[model samples]
Target: MAKELLINGEVITVNANDEIVEAVAIENGKITAVGTTKEILQLQDEETRVTDLAERTLMPGIIESHIHTTMYGANVLAVSCKDPEIRTLAALLQKLKQHASTIPAGQWVRAWGFNETSIEEGRFPTREELDLVTDQHPVMVIRACGHLSAVNSEGLAIGGITRNTQNPEGGEIGRRADGEPDGRLIETAHMELYQLAAHTRDEMREAHRVASAHFAEKGITSIHDATGYGLQNIEALREDAMSGVIAQRVYAMVGALNKPEEVVRHYMQLDICTGEGDEHFKYGPVKMFLDGSSSGPTVWTTAPYTSDSGNYGIHYLAQEELDALFIPAHEKGWQVTAHAQGDAAIDQLLNTIEKALQLHPREDARHRIEHAGLVREDQLQRMKALGVIPTPNPTFFSEYGDGYVTNYGDRAQRMYPLASYYRNGIPATITADCPVADFNPMRGIHSAMTRKAPSGQVIGEDEQIRLLQAIRGYTLHAANASFSEKETGSIEVGKFADLVILDRSILSAEVDEILGIKTDRTIIGGETVYLRSKEPVNV
Candidate 1:
């Protein structure tokens, strides 16, 4: 068989020995050998292709342990409310008016990331206020929390929601002083409008394509796409992978939260999942959400929020209700990654997982807790004991830093404790949680290492992790969380040849310099798929 040799580069093989090799040999899209140039050349036949990358440092392609790729992708093309200049209802209204002109008439105009805390008015935009921007079409703007949606009267009417619409079991409709629906949907209630406007499979595949290219640019070769959005989203990704359009590997989690029967059906069809999808795709885990995001005011907090004394946050399911979903998923041999942010929610999740573990006893299950943002110390120990990986979005430090400090007060110091996880021997991985935060790994690593928020204050200095720890969180630890460490997380011999060559050394660079570390070359399956040099190298 013909062989390929990539020689003369610093290969940081994060294998057992942490081998640093000068060259590697590849055959049939997998590494055949990793050693000195001479050793790799010896194994090559006359038909072998040898390519020297000169001074580049070759390491494992990074893995984003947690993200919502489809949502992120759609957001790439959606109406964005992330503008920094808009700080008041007036400004937001003007921006929406301008945005409406850009879109075709009558199509619903949707926006995301609108936060009351950031706005001068300090409240969700009223449906009446939004109607002024566009009466000809329905307009819906989501709170930055993803747990709430502010809709114009037109939008409310289109969704069949009325003043008498009772709150759904897992969701709420904000009501006026007179008991009329306020056009603000909370928690699961927002799903009614969202589901109606959800993208088709073709749109999702396109979103994945756009998202993959963006990830590749940031040196992210793999991501634990938090949930599949829907079964069609999963199917769309698979179809894209088969057609060779997916440029980054996806560790997909089935996004089945409503239909328990569908969850079981998808679990039973696990045989159809290709855990290994070339270099661009893969599948693992089945996602469930016990609660909503902290920013959303629905995260099942232990205490009432300072602003909302009447509310202790919302729970999508009770303890027993959650266990019914968790136990069966774990028993079916699927890794479970839940969206649990509040301490109360985390405690409930740990209790249920403990029971499931007692029943099944899979010590190395590597079940993950997504957005374990505010875990208690006791919860930390239990997570460590159960090998629950906490896939956190460290980038939250930069985006929602102020809100966290304002919400938790001094206790904000422990919001996303990377150091605590290290001390407890729990594997912690960081990601973008995109559509919520940007999907740049550099930004996340910098946040992990420095604990500095965009507001120029260090929110949790004591909880800051080391640079090496941050790197491993994105690479090795992330792979372990997704159960893909053996093949692709590290640059190891006899493994899939997934390599990321960076423009700068992230390990020895200054904290600020980390953000400038760009991707120079991306190799998947021993083939150079992405290169940005002015001149092409001869192979």
Candidate 2:
């Protein structure tokens, strides 16, 4: 392949020294040189392709450390009940009703991104309310947190759930005063119904295409798919990756939900443990959810919620159960990344991981605590000692910071302590768990640098970090989380040419203006996959 030269731009090489260069040269999909434009041009030959960046800010393509690619792709087709779209209960019903009309009667109608706090009703829409939208169609709307779902009466019937049906051990079914199902399903129950409302393989393929295009347009060249449901989801992802439908490099975490042992066994039989695939697609870790979402008020906490004095949230797994699953996987060399939001859940996760390490110690295992939303000083120290990375969504602070204050009071100050992570020398990765929040990394960067919530309140000003640190959290630190640092994180020599060009310099922009920065072009492996129409340039 001909060498490609990107010049006349600010190349923010997020390397070890955080150097800034004016140009970079790529050969065979890897960076061959980085320096001043004149220096880089010296290496160019007649066969080289030269592209002027118009002084745009060039950097490594943003890496979303935690996301659900397939699900996010599918959600693009689902009815969006997100904020500013449906902020009232009546609006939600109207939106659902409108969506139901677009689909055939008796078919399932799925929607996502519903936040109770944003609605005037200040609660999840009930079955009766959803039934008003469409009794003929089976309707289900998932909360922004992905841990809760509210379904219509038809949806409940389709799932074979009834008043007589008992709640699953790790889940709950909301009930009405008359002992009938009220349409709200939490945690495992929500997941089970979600499985029942499955999409066809063809549908998933289209979803993958849509999602890949969306990510590429947003300048995301890589993502860590936080959850892969089963072999089927994994197969679809692989097929998409191999077929080039998914342009972003994917590191999937095998979800160990429902039948944990069975899932582990299936992966083991296939001999696909961590670090099993190429850069385009790879298996990274075994993921399990130990608690629900803090925003949903279902996260397992030692203290009761401030709003509800008696409710301490839910714990999805027992210690023995966690041990039974994690130990075997750890023994087989699968790094674990468990979702633990509340402090209590964090404690449980830490204990389980400590035991697994003691039984069969693996140095630099890099077991991760996904969304360590709330942690005490002690837990931070323990995380540092265990070499466990805490991957938290800073976007949550900007998008749902008010909700955190409402749910946890002053305790919300401790949520996603980026500054503390830096102080403790804990390598952390900032992510936007898409569908839960917008996938734009700039929003996360802004939130971390300012700690300013959507309500214009600074939840924890002291916890804010520098803009450079936040950027690293999304680039170098994020790649390290997936064990891909050696291959593609920064704009380093010999690294994959996964790079993005921004319209503005985020480094010098005002904190508030950071979110306004736009992607002018996104290139992966020296291939220009997405470029602004007006700034058309050859790949």
Candidate 3:
């Protein structure tokens, strides 16, 4: 159970001539060579397990290209409305009345990353402020753009919602200027208040093992799970990645964002398709939802939104309900997607994936676009002639790049272009839709090379990129968006050693100190699940 090598490192081998190389080599778990450190230590023996890397910065591990992993592992065991720790709305109702006085009385506290523009009363916390965080409990909260939520009036009398309910056809329910039922809830009204306080199967298997050990301590080995709803989040991520309790590596896309036979006619009546499983869970692409959340105002944009006034947001399907689920899952071979972020929901998702590739002409149908979030240079030349895969989420440009230039004005310089997806040869990927941003792939590679925006504002300086194309947009265009780039993105040979060592020298940090560079080990196939402290070596 040994045989790795690693050596005095810098590796960054995001391959195809983007090489850096110093040393590499792993055995049975793949990557068996990459030169120097004296030509790979002359093929070490005696069950070699070297790993020197005193020069730190070995790459390729970090492929989140659109997440939601069981709703960020049940919002990492819920009840913390994020952002500088609940900034204000009276500190998110005093941390929801101290977590609803430690759960009891009619259960369900729920919370999750709330963001009314990182609070200070920018809004959203009333339902009489989550029933002043308790009225025999039933709170809710949500909204760090999980398509809004609010609840608590004992959650509209436990989801019998009221004020003559009605809205649900692409959702809304906010109402209150004498009509009542204002406990927010947008987009299919957050799936029946998230299936009425779900979260059980042993608390979602310890919230996907604390969201896969907090995404392998931010080195995130792999993940696609865009939360398309049913098949119960791909059967609890293929039974928590087949019992090793999910320590990364998963694709899991399935569908159902409000019925269509709960995940496309029940997975086109099984027999598996799209990329299928094994290698710690696979089977992705089939998901839906055609707009909303590019720093919320509810996306679907084709103009109007200089911060509201006649807002052209909210589209939510009806291209015949997204060609009744992405054209027969793109002609029954699978690999299709949605959750677009407005270019009028990426033009109704490129006119239903160009009419399902002109009535089925499939062939590497990468069919993604999850969050192109406002792209439009002729929709990036028709998503580079329909090969379409642009996962895009560069830390949503450092957490909502100044409310994306005050709500899509000047179209926030074609948001999420990532240097126009590497100047047109688009394989572009990069994500972190975590509990809504902060999955930390070095702050999505320094917000794709400083498209900066924590007030020192630089939101989309011509869509900045480069720094190994923002580290191959989270490692090899996020493993070509789950076709798994010949199995696990870079430092390539036979792939999957699934690297990432880093402590410094991401080619000389300082793009706002690359998310304060850290992570000291997070392998995967070649084990070492996550270390966090290991440096000081010489030989």
Candidate 4:
């Protein structure tokens, strides 16, 4: 492969000092040099391909620390029920019926991105309502959080869920006054029914292709897939990466579901540990959910939700059960990243992790708490001391902030304290739990910097961070969360040439205009994978 040079641009290195250079040289898929245009141009040979940025802004390619690639891809094909698309219960049914018309009868139809709070009804669609859309086809529509879902009568029948069927431990099945299934399935119940509607290998492959292309277009050169759906999902992702269908690097967190022992067996059987695989695909951590989602009012919180006076939310695992899973996984050399949203759940996670550390004593394990949504100051101190990284979804502030206010009231002020994390020297990485929120780093950045909700309300002004800090959370800090900081996080010599060219400087853009900035080009491994159609400015 010939060397490449990107010159005459604002190169925001995002390095230790956050250097701004004019040009960068790449060779053999790695950055070879970064300096002034004249200095970098001197290294170019006759075989070199030079891209004059025309004074465009260049930065390290964005990294999404938390996302479900396969699910995101599948959602691309699912019926759209998100706000602004299906704002009312009537609109939702109409959209579902319209989508069901495109498929044959008796076939399953999956839809996603519906938030009850954003709808006119302010509640999940019931089975009878979904039946109005499709009685012949089994229909399942996922909540925006991906933790809750509603299924039609056909879907219930397919899952063998009856009026007498007991809800799985750590999950709930909604019921009507007549004691019949109401179509609302929470946590485990949601996953159980979803499995019945699983996509085929070919469909999954195509989903991956669509997802990878979408990431490239958005300037995301890397992602940490929060849920690697067991060995099959990992193998599929590897195949996608090897076949060049997935252009970005992927770090997969093993999704063992409720069976942590299964994860241990699989790891031992395959002789695969954390950090296994090449740069393009690698094993990250063993992911487990400690509680449900805040959006569903099921997150295990210390206090009862304002919306539900008596309910303190669901706690998925007992202390002993959590210890049983964590200690064994930690001793087996697997890094753990638990999805703990509420303070109570976070407490359980931190306690289990602390115990695991004491029993195993592995320094720099980099155990992560995904979406520490309601972390306290003391928890932050403990997390910092234990070297635990908190990867929070800042995008939630914009997408679900209004709901947060309704759910937690004044407590919402403490949600996702981005500024507090930095002030206390906690290495926080911001993310968008895509499919929960759109996988747009700019929106996450904007939310972090402004703490502004879609309703034009600021939920927590004290938690707002600077633009630079927000950008770092998406780039360098995100890489650090996955232990890939030394590889591709920043623009530096000897790092992989993962870079993005933006139409404007995110640093200097007007606050309201930040999210409007466009990605001019996305380059990975010294190759241009995505380029805008607009003509580049000539130098």
Residue 287 accuracy (lDDT) in model 3: 75
TM-score, prediction 3: 0.35
lDDT of 4 at 40: 93
Best by lDDT: 2
lDDT of 1 by residue, 1-539 (tens): 34678787777777766677788787886888888987887876678787775756677878887777777777666667788778888988888888788878877777888878778988988888998999777888887657688999888887889877888877888888988777789877886677676677767878878887887787777777765346767667767766767777767776643442365456556664325455456667667777877776567788877666777777777888777777877776767667888888889888888888999987588888889888778889999888888887778888788777777666678888999998888878888787778777789888888777668889888899986678778888888887777877776666777778777455567889988888887777766667867675546
User: How do the residues 354-412 of candidate 3 rate in per-residue lDDT, one tens digit apiece?
Assistant: 99899999777888888777888898889889888878776876767888889877788
The full ranking of all candidates by TM-score, starting with the best, is: 2, 4, 1, 3
Error of 1 at 249 (Å): 1.8
The per-candidate count of clashes, in order, stands at 1, 0, 1, 0
Worst 10-residue lDDT window for candidate 4 reads 256-265
Say which prediction, candidate 2 or candidate 3, comes out ahead on TM-score. 2
Residue 138, model 2, lDDT: 93
TM-score of each: 0.89, 0.96, 0.35, 0.96
Error of 4 at 487 (Å): 1.0
Question: Candidate 2: where are CA atoms >4 Å away?
Answer: 256-261
Off by over 4 Å in 4: 256-261, 534-539
Per-prediction CA RMSD (Å): 3.1, 1.7, 20.4, 1.8
| Structural RMSD, model 4 | 1.8
User: In order, what lDDT does every prediction score?
Assistant: 0.76, 0.86, 0.80, 0.85
The alpha-carbon deviation from the true structure for residue 28 of candidate 4, after best TM-score superposition, in angstroms, is 1.4
